[model samples]
Structure formats: structure tokens, C-alpha cells
Target: MTNDSSRASGNQVSWQKRLQDNFDKYIRLVLTLANNSSQASGNEITWQKRLQYKFDNFMSKGGMSVFLALVSVFITAFAVMTTARYVVERFFPNGPTKGTDDLLWEIFVQLIGLRDTGDEANFAAKFVGVITIFMGLVLFSSLVAFITQQFESRLELLRKGKSLVVEENHTLILGFGDRVVDIIKELVLANESESDAVVVILADKDKEEMDDFLRNNIAELKTTRVVTRNGPIANLSNLDKVGVKVAKSIIILNDSKSSDNEQFKTLSDARVVKGILAVVAANGEENLPPIIVELHSEQYRRLAQNIAPGAVTTLNEADILARILVQTSRSVGLARVYLNLVGFEGNEFYFYRSKSGWNNITFGQLPFHLLQAVPLGIRHGDGTLTLKTNKDYKLSKDDEAIVLAGDDSTIEFFPEPVVQHNRIGCVERNQTLELETENYLIIGWNSKTAIALEEYAKSVVKDSQVNLAVEVLTDEIKAEFENIAKAYPHIKMEVMQVNMDSLDQLKTLKPYKFNSISILAGSGENAEEIDAKTLTILLELRQFFKEYSAATKTKVTTNLIAEIIDSQNTDLVIKAGVKDFLLTNQFVSKILAQVSQEPDVMSIYEDLFSLDGSELYIKPIWLYFPANQIGKLTFADCILAAQNRDEVCIGVRISSQAQIKNKNFGIYLAPTLDKDFILTVYDALITLADDQN
Candidate 1:
């Protein structure tokens, strides 16, 4: 039993030893496999997972993602390279070192699984890295292009609101002055029928003045869009602002309130003309329309004509005013009548074939044929005003019929020829009733004063008394009037030596309330004080005279002529209620300016002022006779009327409403074929003629 126990114990010990050895070996083997597997898996995941993480980062962050991805790829390649190089060097340290190309090829071959060893695997990793780098570079290039485009789009929206472009068919007036208002009024009437008309005024004056004038006087123009631009006519750049290149018609107004001196007027006019020429040249003649210029000096009209060959140049001052005074003075409605003769509305002078119905008709028979219209006169081949020409003056084919008709004038002839009515005898005054004239007070003096005095003398009746009141500032004037007083013994002339500035002294001259008093310029004074004093004295005289001549036909004519060193004073002077405030400086300035353009108008002016067949006379046309027609009548007809009765038809004014139907109608000139030209009460004036009776 002792022997058996010992053997069993030995066996157990042996078995235990064997079991312990096996367990130890097994544990070691298991640990080695786990470590190897973990290492291999970690290596594979390190390259691939790291590359994926970098790629994700590159996508999220535009620029940084590319860098991090590249870094990750390079690190993976290096790791593989290090392992392969170690294996190659350890295995074959003495062997020849491979060239860069051969090694790269081997790496590519290993990555594709065609080569053996870690060196080839390392090269394969590098090849994969190259492909990843190329992809990242492509992404970065696309990102840069997109970013640049976005930046460029933002810059394009900031450059589209400051250019000036004009529209078509605009009326362009090159200068602004007093005449501007008149012209604008005419244009307003002319354009009343059109769809749209734009008037553009180019002036050197302040825009406010132009705007205010237009607003106050031409409220109708506001709807039409009147544009006022600050521009000098002398400069092409300024002219462009007025859209002269696209203008329909340009009327060059000679400035009214320029320097009174003729030389200054000429200089300014020349400059304006030259500027107009330059603008026309630049715009090209074919594109430009008609250009009308105003001339004050009739002598300089040729010069103006030369500037714009076909343009109508008129002596604005001498022609317009002289006609007004000469015609309106004697004839009651002559001014109104004259306006119709030339105006576009109501009645106008027109010419037609005489054979229509007037071919065989005599002057007397014309009234019968033209029952609706009156045969006022006829135009012979030679222009003459033959009022008493035989009713049987043989009518010919070449003769043009001149007749006056209203809108309702009938074209049908009368049923029977009526005998001419006998004229009524005139009631002659018993003994030529002497016209009574009280003391005439003439205050302050000017060039116009002399002419006015001459006119006043001619206008005054024979037994009229006169007096001269002078603010004697110098010995020369005092002596000149004293000698004149001696010559006119029939009239008492009083010379006052008092301070015109002092209101008290002015009141002492009680003669201001005379039947006819004309306060002219203030002496030895600046324009402002002169204008102020003149206005004050005139106002006071108006009030005082109105009281004195309580039941008399008293006429007070004041002169606001030479006081215009500044044009702004016109408002104040006009407000004083002076009936005839002759603005001499304004008138003279306009005259000098106009004449500088057209010099030949002087003779026309002389004819206008004279009291003969050529004078400015308003003759009353007998439209009741049914043959004296003013509408569509020729100028030759007007001359014939004047020849018989010593009168002339110069201008015509028509009612505003009628102007619309006659679209091209204007107050300044007669229409070619207006059928409604009838003579009103104020058509023409009669001057002294040779008494044929």
C-alpha cells in the first residue's frame, strides 16, 4: 500500500506539470495572435480612415480641407515607405540601392497586387496618394472659380441714374427777355390744337425769373411742360443743354434791356448771331428748321439776314411801337382791326382766283355777289390802296379777290344787284371849336422827351396853352428853356428851380394837376433813386390830378423810359398806376439791339410814322357792304384801300378762341387761306391825305 501511494502521487504531479505547461503555451499563442491581428487592423484603418477624415474636412472647410487631406495622404504613404524600406535594408543592406523610377514602378506594381514585399506596397501607397492629391486639386480649383464669380456679381449693380437725354419735337427759344412772354403766348395759341408741344427756354437769366414769369402770366403753359435751362447762347456746350440739335424751330430774341448805346447793342447782337451760326453749323442745316431773329436797327437787318439767310429779321422796336401809336391814336378800334388783318384767328387776308364769282363783278357789284363778306378793296397788279376805284374796274383772270369773311360767311351770291347807298353828310363844328389846353407840366428830360414834345405839339389843337416845368440842375438847361419860353408867347412856360427829391418841393409845383401832365426822367440821380422818386411823384400826381379834374377828361402820361438801370424797377413803376409809362431805356435798348440786326427797317419805320398813304393808319373797313373782306385778302388789297382813303393794314389781333381752328394762325402774320378775316372797329388809321374832293 505504501508503494502504490507513492506512484499515484508521482503520476499526479507529472500530469499537473504537463497541464500547466500546455496552458502556458496556449495563453502565449492566444496573446500573440490577438496582438498581431490588432496591429494589422490598426495599420489598415490608419491609412484609409485617416484619408477619409481628411477628405470630409476638406469638403467642410474650403481651403484648409485640401491641405489636411494632402497631409493625411502623405503620412500614410510615409508610414508604408518606412516599413518597406526597413524590410528591404534589413534583408539586403549590401545590395544595390534602387533608382527613384524603379522604386516608384515597384510601389505601383505592389499597390496593384502584382508585386511582392513591403517596398512595393509602400510605392503603391504613394500612387494612391497621387490620385487623391489630383482630386483635391480639382476641388480647390472649382471652389476658387465659384468664389471669384460670386464676388464679381456683387460689383455690377452700382452704376445706372445720371444721364440726360432729350425727347423729339421740342420748341427751342435761345434767349429770354420781355419778348419771350409775347412769343410764348403766340406759341401757346399755335399749339392748342396739337397733341403735345414742348417749349424749352435757354437763358442766361436765373431760372427763378423765367419760371415765375411763366407761372404768373402763362398758367396754361404749366400743363405743357416748359423747361427753363441756364445757358449762354454764345457757347455750344450751353446750346447743347437746350437741345438745339433736336429743336423744331428756334426764334432768337434780341435782348430787350441791354445797354442803350448802339455799339453795345451791336456787339451783343453780333455775339448772339455768331453763336446761333455755330449751333446751326454743328447741328447741320438739314436737321435744323427755320431761325427768326429780331433786329432793332433797320440798317443792321442785312447783317442779320446774312447770318441766317432765309430767316425773317424784323426791327422789333420801331416797327411795332410806331405802328401802335400811329394807328391807335386816331382810329378807335384800329389796333384791334389791324390784329385781325395779320392774325391767324377771326379774319385774315387771303387771295383766291377772281373768276370764281368776282371775275366780272365791279367794286359795287362785289358787295352783292359776296353777300356774306364785304369787298373792302382789291389788289391790282401794282400794289395801291384805291378806295374810290370804279366799281366797273375791269376784272381780269390774273386779278386776285380780296374780301373779308367771318366763320359763317356764305359763298352764295345775292339774288339781285342792289344800288350803292348814299353816304351821310358830316356835321361841321360852328367855328372850329378851339381845343383848350391848360398848363402842361414836363418833368425831367431825355431824348424821347424832345420827340414826345414834338408829337404833343402836332397832336395839340391850335388854341391849347402849354407850360414847361423843369428841375433845373444846370445853367445850360435853364437858359435853353428860358429862350424857348420867349419864342412861344401865346403859352406860359414856368421853370421851377426846386429839389425834385424833396416831396415838399414837389408838392409846391401845383401844376402837376394840369389837363395833360407828363413826368419824365429824374435828373442828376442814380437809377434806383430816380425810379423811386419818379414813381412817388407820378403816384402823387395821379391822386392829386384825379381829385382836381373831378369831371374832366384828364389824361396823364408818365415816362418810365430812361430810369431802367435795372429792370426790376418795372414792377414798382407799373404798380404806381401810370397809364403811359414809356420805358425809354427798355425801348431804346430793344431798338438798338434790333436795328443792329436790320438797318433798312429805318425807312419802313419812317413810313410807319408819317401821315400819308405810307403812314401807320387804322382805316375802318366797311364790312357791312358785304364785299369788304379782310379774311384771306392779299396785301395788295390792303394797299388799294389805303390808296383811295390814305390808310394801311399792318397787323391784326384776333380772338383767342378762333386761333385753334386755324392751327398755323398767329397774331403777327396773316394766314394764307383763312376765310374768316373780317375788319373790326379797330382795323386801320387815317393820315392826312390830299383832299381829292
Candidate 2:
């Protein structure tokens, strides 16, 4: 019995051992399968990621991607054709076979849907031919669709102005605003002498819209070709695309929409600074072209100059207009002279450098040598400009004549004097008048109002009265006026809130009592609306003056100086009997365009506009010549007469043509030496002088 029990225990042990070994084998198999499956899944994921990465890289190349896609389609088509042709030829021996080239050509023709399925002897070959035709249809359709899509994309890119400009020596303009059209118009006139001049404009605007605006505004482009590109001007890539490196000059215009808002103006000025920096980056500091930038803030202008030193030219619109306002207000017919001087359509400022003939000639005698040009100043070799120099000042070999001429080609240097001795009249210089206190009536208000007031303070005598009338006066405006009044204690300031639209309120101001009436452009979102308000006020004042003259039999001789924001309204203003009107946008744009052409003119204009140095004035004809010699004197005689008084006579204003808009208010600049002018005591002589007297 014991032997039997031991044998049973050993059998149980053996069965348990078999179960353990089997369990161990099953566990090993499961782990091995899971490891293999995990590795395989990871490899598949890695392969897909690599394929996606390659496809993204390939698609990033615009034109090249399309070309490669077409090549791949062709390659796949060839492979499929080879495989199908071999299967049909090898599998169905009964079918009629063609040469390799013929078979390939047949497949190509079928792929393009040019031919139907050809004859085949067996069912298998016929079946395969049907499949090939079906595959061809699908592949070719997809290929055509893809090509069409790519073509559309390329066209879209072109419409968006993403294409690079392949030009050199072009005038590159980097922003768009109200001043752009004026700048372009001036550039067009300036390029009339050049056969193939180009002006490229880049801005953050719609390309089509910009093109349309330019086309409608510029009636005649003359010899200039304007090309526009749409992009952020502050982008380096965009700067490169516009060929900044090869440009001759660049003009950066401020945002017109932001001109009224201080916050936006700050932002706009920052963008301009960024754009200037980007230009330097694209072209490198040493390779930068002449850059002309318009900045509202003085801080930005200083910053820009510091960035590029002598390479950058900055313009302050408000400051220029303010100085012009002060000068024009004091003179009756000086606005036309300034317009003619700064613009390209009329007499323009030019620098003439002569190698031999211009040396050792007095500043006053230099005008006698030139046939049509009038010398205003001398530019030294070290780049210092002296406008209205003394008559005894002699020109050196290194000096350049700053002359006003109709065109650069008309500026000629005669070795001998071309003086018309008969036309030269002898006259005595008139006595200087003392500066007197005056009353000024200013209607309406704008950003230039405060600056204009400051300019008046600089010129007006102590106890001069200034009356400001506006439709609405806010706290901010009141504060500004108070601050200006405090800053200039000598000038008397009076602010009144009057409804300018009401003629009764305007009549109460007694505008005729003032010496000068300035109608400023009102503030509004629409420039037309602002100008319309100014026009309304102007008409009311004129009617009131006419009626008052008839009722009281008192001669009212108050000069009207209107500030026009849009140049298109200049004619309307002139027609309304406004002899002295300022086209604010056009004037600033002219300066910017002129400076871009000749950077030295900026300093000349600065000197002319500032009160510290010489400025333009339209004095009475009696001031330059005696009453008896006025009618008999030629323009050259007047020029000589002005020289005796330390002033430069550039033109004459006739009182007869004062109301004629087409006659340029009777102002003739740089007239021929032989041209005779029958001047009167009432008529004025346009001259560059130290003071209004």
C-alpha cells in the first residue's frame, strides 16, 4: 500500500511541472508579439511623419513646386504605361504587338484623351486596356485640375503685388496719404525732361485701389511712370522686393488719417522710424540712398537725423505752414511767389556750379550775366547756403549760385555780361518803415492754428491783437490757447465760441477793423466738409465787406489769407477773391518732392521760412524804385534797385491782375532782363529780404 501511495505523489508532481513549463512558454510568446507589434507601429508613424515633412518642404517653393509636380505626373504616367504594356504583351501572346516607341506613343495619346482603345486579340488584353484608359482619365483629369489651380494661385499673388520689382534707379515712395498725389504730380512735372523716369510706390494699401486713385488724380503723368506695390513698408522683405538697394531716392509720407489724432500720429511716426530703419537694414548704412521722411513730431525728426546723419532729410508740415502763414499774412501777394518758387510747374530753385565763369562776380551783378535765371543766394563749397547775401559779396570759385529758373536747361552761364544797358534804370532806395502793432482776425481752427499763432507772436509787435473764432471750443482747445497766450505774453489773445455758419454772428466780430483775416480749415473726418465750412465763412465775410463798404462808404482793405487743405479746391478759393490761399497738402508735398531731388534745397527753404534769416516779401513798387521811375523800369532795373537795399527782387505783382486766377495774381518770377514792367505805387515787388520792411 505505501509503495502505491508514493507512486501517486510522483505522478501529481510531474503533472504540476508540465503545467508550469507550458505557462512559461505562453508568457514568453505574448511578450515577444507585443514588442514586435510596438516597434512596427512606431516605424509606420515615423515614415508618415517624414513623408508629410518632405511634402510641406516641397510645396513651400512656389513655382518650382508646380514644375516638379508636373514632372512627377509625367514620370508616373510613363511607369504605368510601361507596366501595362508589358502585362498585355506578355500575358496575351495572341494579341498583335507594336514597337516600344509606338506603344509608348499610344499610351501617351490615350492619357491625354486624344484616342480610344485600340484592337486586342484576347479577353485578358482587352480588360487590361480598359483599365489603362480608366486610369489615364483619372490621372490626366487630376493633373489638369492641379495645373489650373496653380495658375490661379500665381495670378492671385500678382494681384496682391507680391512680385518683386526688377528695376534700378527708381524713385521709391514708401507710404500713401493725401500728399502722395501731390508728390507724384510734382515728380511727373520734374521728370518731363527725362525720357524714362520711374516712381515706384509701396504702401500698406490695396494694390488695385492705389492704382485707381493715382490714375484718377494725376490727369497727366508726362514722362514719369508710376508703379505701385502693396505691402507693409516696415518689413525688410518688402523693402527688398521694392528694390530699395538700387533706388535713387526714397520718400516716406506720414499717415494722413492720423494727422489729427495724437495717439495715431505717435504710432505713425513710430512706423516711419521703423521704415527708415528697415531701409538702412536692406541697403546697409553705407549703401543707403537719399531718404526724405515727413514727421509731425520734432522728436522723431531728430531721431531720424541721428539714425542716418546727412543721408536723411526730414520735413515738418506744421512748422513750414506756420512760417508761411506768418510771412504771407504780412504780405499781400507773396503766396503766389512761394507757390511758384517751390513748385516744378513754374520757376524752381536750382544750384549751378561753374568751373570757371562764375568766379569773382558780386552777388548783385550775377543776375546780369544770366539770361533768364535770377540769383537768390550763394551755396558755399562746405554746404552752407546764404540767401540774399549783401550786394558786395563776391562769388568764389568754390561757390554755387542758387538761382531761380524756368528749367534747368534754361540756366546758362555767360562768360561776358549780357546786361541790357538801356533797360537798366537809376532809382533811389525807399526809406524803411517802422514795425507797427496790428489787429488780426482768425476764423476757424485746426492743427496748424496754434503753430500759426506762435509764428505770429514771433513776428507781431507788442500789444498786437489776435481774435480766434470757432464753431465749438472744447476744454482741450481752450487749454492750448491759454498755454500759447501764456508763452507769448506780448501778443494779446481773445478766444470766442461763435457759430461760424451764422452770418449774424460773423458780422458782430467787426472783421473789417482787423488788418488781416485768416480763414483756417475746420477739423472734421471729411476733408471736403472741412474745406466747405471754410468756403462758407469766406463767402459770408466777402459779402459782408461789400455791403459794409457800400453802406458806410468806408474803404475796407483787409487782406484775406485762407488755408486750403485740398489742392483741388484752390481754384474755387481763388475764384472767391481769395488772392492769398495756402494749399497746405500741396505745399508740403512740393517741398518734400523738391528736397528729394536736391537735398540742399531743404536748408534753403528752412532759411527762407524761418524768421531769423532772410524771407520772401512783397513790398510796394515804391520801396524799390521812385514813383517817377516805377513805370519806366525793367525787371532787371528792379533787381538792381533791390540789390541796393540788400534784398533780392524775384518778381513783380501788378494790381490790375490781382483778381485774375489764371494770371497767377499778376506775379511774374524770373522774367527776362529785357522784359519791361509798367509798375505803379499800388503794385508790389516780390523780394527776398531780412524783414518785411
Candidate 3:
């Protein structure tokens, strides 16, 4: 029994030993499997992360980069399929052996979905064929989408006006404003004789918006082709894009919307200065074109000229408008004469340099030597203009005749003098009405008010009265008026706060008593609103005058001059019985355009508008022709008569045709010297003289 028990124990122990050995082996196999699984998982995760990072980076570079990446993937797929087919055919032979060219061609066709792998004996060849077909679908779809996106991107760039202009001798307008339409219209008229002319505009405005605005404003562009681009005017790249280097002329317009605000005007002037600098920098100093800039402040105007000396021509709008207002207020038909003189639609000033016949000719006789033009001044070789010179002054060799003609081509110097002796009537002496102290009325106010008042002080006789009326009376305005009054002690100045809306209040001032009434545009409003207010006041004044004249049966001869901000509203005002009105923006724009074409004319305008120089006046017809010969004399006779008085007969104003709009309000400028006119005693002669007398 003991022997049996010991044997059973040994057997159990051996069995237990065998069980432990099997369990150890199982544990070792389990750890080995876990280790292998972990390493394989780590490798797969690393590979996935690398692919993700590369894809993200490629996508972040934008659509073009993504498109290029897709193209690369397509090429890689094609290469892989081709190589795989080659390998399968060489290492593992297919059903039929194909040449290298045939193999590559077949792979390409399959990848593009043009063909399928038919009856391929090799399994590897079939697998690669299917993969290539799938990749082709994905890659081609992505490529189409990317190509469409690229096309859209290109269209967007075009809409933004990012393309450069390829033009030469074109007019480059650096900014846009209310004056742009007028400038362009004038340019169109100026370029009517040319076959093709371009006016490229670069402004901080939408290209489409500018195009639409211009299309609506200008009825016909004639021969001028307008191109618009959107960008900062002061940017060098933008200036280059507009072809600044090859430009014939450059006009920098002041921000008309900001003209009333000092801060905004300063910023606008700074931008103009920067734009001028940009133009000069873009096109070297030697290659700089004639640059015309309109600046509100005189300081900036001087600065602009100092920067580029002879290359820059600056315009002071306030000064010019003020002078024109004062001069226009002094006469009844002077505004029409100015309108006829400064624009391209009518008689324009041109510099005529004769080859030989004009040498040593007297200024008075030069008019007879010209066919259709009137000699107004002489532009010397030194660039000095002598306007309304003495008839006895002789022409110099370097002098260029500054004549007013309907067209430049019509300005011809005839070798023989043309004079109609029969139509030349004797100069008649007429009594002139003189008033030592004049009464003037100024309604509303603007930046031009003080300057106009100063001009009045210099122009009017001693003890002349000026009554300034306004809707709102602020200390600033009062102070400005006081300063002006202090400076001009010769004139009696009166300031009153009157609501222009109240006709009764306006009547209380006895506006009919004033010799001349000037209406100025108000501030703090857009041009349309300001013009509306001005038009309203004008209608009110006209109504009051009509009623007063009818009620008292007394003829009211008050000369009314209104300031019109928009040229579109000029016709409305004119129809409202405003014989004389200043189209502010159009007037300035005409001057700018004319000066850009001929910078020397600016001096002529400056002199013509100033008080110290010779000015335009409408004198009684009897002063130029005898009362008996009023209806029988020709325009040439009138010219000869004016020459006797040391004056220039530029035009005539007929009372019978005064209300006729188509007849130029009865004002004829640079009329044919032999054209006969049936004039009455009431009609007047338009002449340029040293004084009204």
C-alpha cells in the first residue's frame, strides 16, 4: 500500500510538471503576438499621420497649388499603372506579349476610361487596370472642378480692373468727382477732330460704377474713348497701369464732395500731392507730362507747383469762382460771354504763330489780317500774355497771336487785310448812366463769399452798399464778415439773418432796391441738394420780382446771378428767368480741360476775370454805331467802330433775341465781321475794354 501511494504521488507531480511547461509556452506565445501587433499598429499610424500632414500642407497653398498637386497625383497614377503592366508582362507573362509602346498606350487608354482591360490572363494586370480606372475618375473630376475654379478666379481679376492699360498719348485723369463728367465731355468735344483719342481714368471707385455714371451723364463721347480702372490714385502701380508714362496730359481733380470741409480738403490735397509725386516718380521728371491739378487751398497749389515747377499747373477754384462772380455781377450779359469763351463748344482761345506775314504788324491791324478769328492778346515767347493790348502796340517776332476762333483750323492769317468799308459805320457818342454809390445784395454764403466781398470792395465805388443775408447767423460767419468789412472800409457792409424760405422776410429787405442780387450755394449738403436750395431761392426771387413789377407797374432792373452747383440744373435755372448763372463745376472743369490743352490760356482767363485787368462789358449799341445806322450796320462795321475806342468787339447782344436760348441768349461772340445785324437802340455791343466806361 505504501509503494502504491508513493507512485501515485510521483505521477501527480509529473502531470503537474507537464501542465506548467505547456502554460509557460502559451504565455511566451501570447507576449510575442502582442509585441508584433503593437509594432505593426505603430507603423500604420505613423504612415497615416505623414500622409495627412502632406495633404493639409498642399491644400493650404490655395486652389492653384491643389490643382498642381492633383495633376501630380494623376501623373503618378499613370506612371504606376504603366510600370505595373510592364513588370507583369516581363516577369509574369500575360496571354499575349505586347511591345513597350503598345503596353504604355493600353495603360494610358485604360486610365482615361477610353478602354478596358479585355481578357487579361495576368491577375496583377487586371488589378492595376481597375485601380487606374478608378483613379482616373477621381482625378479627372477634381481637375475639372479646379479648372472651373481657376477660370472663375481669372474672371474676378478682370472685374476688379487689375489689367494694365496699353495706350500712348492718352489723357490720364488721376481722380474722379463731379467734375469728371464735365471734363470728359469737354475732352470729347476737343477730340472731335481726331480719329481716336483715349481718356483713361484711375480713381478709388468701382470700375463698373464709373462706367455707368459716365454712360448716363455724357450723351455722346464723339471720338474720345473713356477707360476706367479701380485703384488708389496715389499708388505707383496704379498710375503705371493707367499708362502715366505715355500719357499726353494728367488732370488731378479735387474731391468735390469734400471741398467744403477743411479737414477733408486737406486730406484731399495731400492725396493730390501724393498723386502728383507718384506720377512724377512713375514717369521720370524729364518724361513728366503736363499735369493739371485743382486744389482748394492756395498753399497746396503753390506747393504742387513748387514740387514740379513748370510741369504742374494748379487751379484755385475758390479764387477763380469768386472773381468770376464779382465780374459777372457787374454786367448783365457777361456770364454768357465767358461761357462762350472758355469752352470747346463755342469760340476758344488759340495761340497763333505766323511764319512771316505777322512780323512787325500792329496789334490793331492784326485782326484785319485774320480771316475768322479775333485777336484778343499776344503770347510772347517768354510765356507772358498781354491781353487787350493797345491797338498801336506792334507785334514782335516771338509773339503768338492769342485769337478767339470757332476752330483752330479756321485761324488763318491773310496776307491782305479784309475790311468792308461800306458796312463800317461812324462811332456814335452816347450818354452813359453813372451811379457813384451802388447797392448790392448777396443771399446765402459759402467759401467764395468773403473773396467775392473783397472783390466787390476793390471794384465798387466808394460808399457802395453790400447787404449780406443768410438763413443761419453763426459767430464764425459773423467774424468772417467783420474781418472782410474791416479790410474794405470804402464799402458799407451789412449782415442780416433772414430765412431765405420766407418770401415776406426777403421782401422786407426790399431786394428790388439792390442793383444786383447774387445767390450763393449753401454748405453741408450734397451738390444736388445745394442746387435745389439755390433753385428754390431763385424761383422765389423771380416770383417776387414779377409780382412787384406787376403791382407797382415799375420795371425792375435788378441783375440776378445764381450759383449753380450742377451743370444739369443750369437749363432749369435759365428757364426760371435767370439770365446769368454760374455753372460752378462745369466752369471749373472747362478751365481745367482748356488749361490742360493749352496752359497759357490760364493766364488769359486769370486776367479776364480779375478786376485790375481788362474785362468784358456790354455797352449801348449807339456807343459803337450811330442811332441812324443801327439797323443797317454789319458786324464788321461794329468791329471797326470798337477799334476806334481802343476796345475789342467780340460779340453783340440783341434785345429782340435776348430770351432766345438757341440764339445764345442774343450774345454773339467772334461773329463774322461782314455779317449784317438789324440792331435796336436797346441792343448792346459786347466788347473787351479797360473799364466799363
Candidate 4:
């Protein structure tokens, strides 16, 4: 490390020394030009040269020519119009005299007016007035029009998004991120019902850049007109420019690109909060729209909420992604289910007030009552959500049942028969205590590492051990681990320093022995680089598993899950038999986008994501199937069986080792109620029940 004096010596430089090094010759040349110009021209500048230089200087100012030309045209038009009015008055005294005010206004508007002047004209005076009007209009009107166009074009360049946005009750997105195009696409799907729905995005990026990015990504927007404005998201002027006050909902994207850096992420989060505050202030403590702001850290969620009390909601990306990873690491295809629900392109979460004489029934009877939708939970009028409602919980008329359906309009129940099971086969037995030791290898680290470890530890057995491997464990990383250890003592954490770039070193770890392997996205200068490193690590893991299995003469099997930053890179790691790919920003962005469309959906998101709440689980068929009931059972029987145990059977997961795109993953969500739902011993039933772990 350099001493303060040495650092000062390196930084400080006198102006004379700086000029002598690189700029002295150029400065002396300029000075010589000025001196020679003065001396050669009798030691004084000529009047013509002075005037020409002043005119050129004046012309160099932006819009100065347009201003001067408009002024000149205005003076010329005034002289021409005034002379025409005088000529008409003097030449035709008998002509009908109009007031000066009326005459001046008529002359000013006649330059661009389309109305015929023949009807108001009479003879020579009228003809002279019309001729004078034509002359001025022909010359000055064209000049003025050209000047106006040029000025407007200049203003359009400098004053970004200067036009007043007239959209009302539209969704407003306050920032731009890699997920913006996805959000816009989802909004387009959401706006398919209405012809005039608009999604106005206000970001710090250039308007043309945003528009081009969206156009390049999304081929067709259908009915949605997405308007982009380039300005500071936290600025009140920009908020008004995008019509935030009249917006129906707002999504504050934490587009803080460096999400791994704590200080930078927090600074970006502060900007989001400031933007929310500006919107709330603009709404005037009145009917503020539902604002969904994305914060990078959970510690700032409440801080943002306090900034704007009512209707201001926040989602912590790290915390939410950590929970999702922990949950999906155990159950394959569960992340797909979440992605489908949160994204508007597929079957999604819908809330409906049961008005068909079923409001007085218990929630357990909900599935049989709904059409093709399954009742996942209910929300009270007071804004409380019981996502996994108890079987005996009776819903009132004011309460709305949250259903997993194809569309919001299709949430009604159909009058169909609940097919009974013909033959009850033997079901699998349940294992109460998981005393078997499980090993987990966690590779790489990010802002979510500590939270993910804590959540993962909470879901694992008491003696379960976690082998953490990273390139370097700094004091900060150690501190994060200490915090996790203090929170979760059941998890035995071990740290290993290894170079992940070397495939041989990755093989030395023997990742297949672990019950599950998590390769987190490495934090670098940008998300693309981070994703590249993550992809590299994923390939190494793939090769490690393949070579190990080849050398040992065994079939390859391991629960591999990794975090992907960029959505475009998901395909690169898909062939590696990874159980789940957690596209962190894409999922959160979709949720925020979906919530912006329907504020009530936030409750569904909350109920589905909360850790302590009743969550969806992929329990082994042996755990749910009774001793006498197994094999090919109807989905209705599956539901009935789970209902008997006070649980809701949403779907089934058949293939344990499968990629996401493969329907062979055999994870059927919202399957037909009466269809034959075959449950093999290796398959698991996806049910909405208590967190069995």
C-alpha cells in the first residue's frame, strides 16, 4: 500500500507541469495563431471580421438561429399585415370595418387558416388585403413553419419525453431492467381484453433505446401500446411526464445492475424508494395507486413501506429468490409452476368472490365447487390471505377464494360429477424423522448466499451438512456465514477454497456424493459476465458428474440446481440435468408485472411465497398413498385422498431426473379432476400442504 504522501505525489500535478507534459505545444500553437492573426491584421481585428465572428458565435448557440429567424419573420409578417390592413382601410373606406382586435387576430390566424377568404372579401381593398395576406403567408408562414419544425426537433432531442402523457388508469413501470421486455410482453397478454390499455415505462434510459430494445425482443404487442420516456425515475417532473398520478398501478424496478454489491444495491433501492415517495406525494395523500417496488434487500422493505404508507408494496429480490431456491431445490418442476402462475402467459393465480351460492361452504369443498380451477386459498375483505386455508375454514360472502385457473374469468365452478375411485391400491408409507445424514455442496456466492443458507438449513435435517466452496472467503463472507450460523444452528457449514475454473479441481470435490448441488451465479462486473462464469461452473459440474459416473461404472444421479442471471442463458445449462433453473430477476420481474396488472394478486404471491405458511410440497407417492390405495388412481380420488388428510393435491411430479422443457418431467399442474392420475413408486404427488421438511 502506498503512503498518503506517495499517493498525493502521484495524484497532484501543477497546471504548468501538466501543460509542459502533453498540452503545452497545443496551447502555444493556439496562442501563436491569435498573436499572428492580430499582428498580421495591423495589430487590430477589422469591424467586418469582428461582426462576422460575433454573428458566428451567436449562430453557434443552440436554437439561436430559429429564435432569430422566428423574430425576423414575426416582424416581417407584422409589417406586411399592418400594411395590408392600412391599404384595405384607406382603399375601401366603405368596406365593413372590423375591430382592431378582431382584425389583428384574423391576420395572425389567416397565415395558417384553411378557411376561404373570398366570402369575407368584397373588391380591390379586399383583393389587396388577400394579396398582402397571400404574400406574407407564402413567405413568412413557410419560414415560420420550417422554423417551428426545426425548433421542435431540437427540443425533442434535449427535452426527453416533453409531451404530456394523457394515459389514465394505465400501468406505469418506473425503471428499466433486463426483465423489462418480459414485463411488457406479459402486460401485452394482460391487455388483450381491452383495446386502449397502455403500459407507459419511465426509465433512465433513452426513449429510443427502450423502444428499440422492446421492439427487438417482442415481435408483436397486439393491443397494448407501450410508451417509453427517458428521465430520472425519482424525479417528480418525470413522474408527471409519464402520468404517474393517474396511473392505476406502478412497478418500481430495482434495475441496480450490480446486485451483488451491497452499497450499490442499497443505493439503487434508495432510488426506488425515492421514486415511490415522489409518486405518493404526487397522488396527494389520496387515492394512490398500488405501488409495487422491488428492493434488493429485505432490510429495506419496511423502510420503503414507511416512506409511502398505504398501497405501497415491496418485494425483496434476494429474500424471495432464496426462499424459492430452497423450496424448489427439493421439488423439481415446482419453479415452473410458480413461473406459470406469476407469468400471464399460462395458468395463473386468480381471486374471485364465490357468488354462486357456495360462499357459506368450507374451503376444502372449494375444488369440487370450482369449474376447472383449484382453490388454493382465500382472502378476507380486510386484506388478509390464508393461502392454504384449513379444510374446515368457512368462507363468508365478503371473502374471496384464491383459485389456480387458466383465466380470471374462468374461475366459476362447473356442475360435474366427482368421480369416485373404483379400486383403492396400497399407498406409500411416511417417514417421520429423516435421521439419515444428507450432504449438500454449495458453489459460488452472491447477496442471497446467507439468506439461502439459512432457509436451506431450516428445511434440512438436524445433522445435515453443507459444503460451501468459493475462490476466496473474505472477512465479509465470513461475517455473512457467522450471521447464518447464529440464525440456524442445525446446519453444519464447512467452507472450502477452490478454483472453479479448473475442471480437475471440480472433480476432486466429488459433487455426486452430495444429496444436492447448488451452483450460484458468480458476481462480476456485470450480469452477462456473471452468467458466463455460472455457465462455466455448470459445465464443469456436468463433466465432473459424467466422468465420475463413467469411471465408477454407475448411473449419474444428483440434484443439481443453479441460479441464472440472464434469461437468455437458460438454455446453455439446461442439458446438464439440472433440477431447477432459478432465473432470479425474471421471476421477480414477472411477479411485479403481474401484480401491477392486479393488485389483489399480491396476496396470492405472498401466500405462495411465505416460508412459514403452508406451501406446495412434492411428497413421495409412498408418503401420501395409503397401504391399500396406490397405482393408477383418478385425480379426483387423489384430491379426495388428500382432502381426507386435510391437504389439497394440486398436481403430480413423475420423473425425478428431467429437464424443465420436457413434459416428461411428468409434473402435471391443474390436471383434469377425473383423469387417471398414475402414481408410480418413484413419482411424487405435488400437493399444497404444510412444509413437510
TM-score, one value per model: 0.48, 0.91, 0.84, 0.78
* Cα lDDT of model 3 by residue, 524-587, tens digit: 5688988888888899989999999999999989988999888999789888888788989989
- Which is the leading candidate under lDDT? 3
Model 4: per-residue Cα lDDT over 389-489, one tens digit each? 78898878788777777777776664343444443542322433254666777887776677778777777888788778888888888877877776767
Order the candidate numbers by lDDT, best to worst. 3, 2, 4, 1
CA deviation > 4 Å runs, candidate 3: 1-133, 256-259, 356-359, 419-424, 428-436
lDDT of 3 at 249: 93
TM-score of 3: 0.84
lDDT of 1 by residue, 2-105 (tens): 98999999999999999999999999999999999999887776777888887676668754565455556544654565466546555655246676677566
Cα-based lDDT for every prediction? 0.50, 0.84, 0.85, 0.74
| TM-score, cand. 4 vs. native | 0.78
Task: Quote the positional error of residue 39 for candidate 3 in Å.
Answer: 22
Model 1 residue 664 CA deviation in Å: 26
Cα deviation at 35, candidate 3, in Å, is: 23
Error of 1 at 120 (Å): 42
* Stretches > 4 Å off in candidate 1: 1-171, 205-213, 222-225, 236-249, 256-267, 279-290, 297-299, 306-310, 318-357, 360-535, 547-693
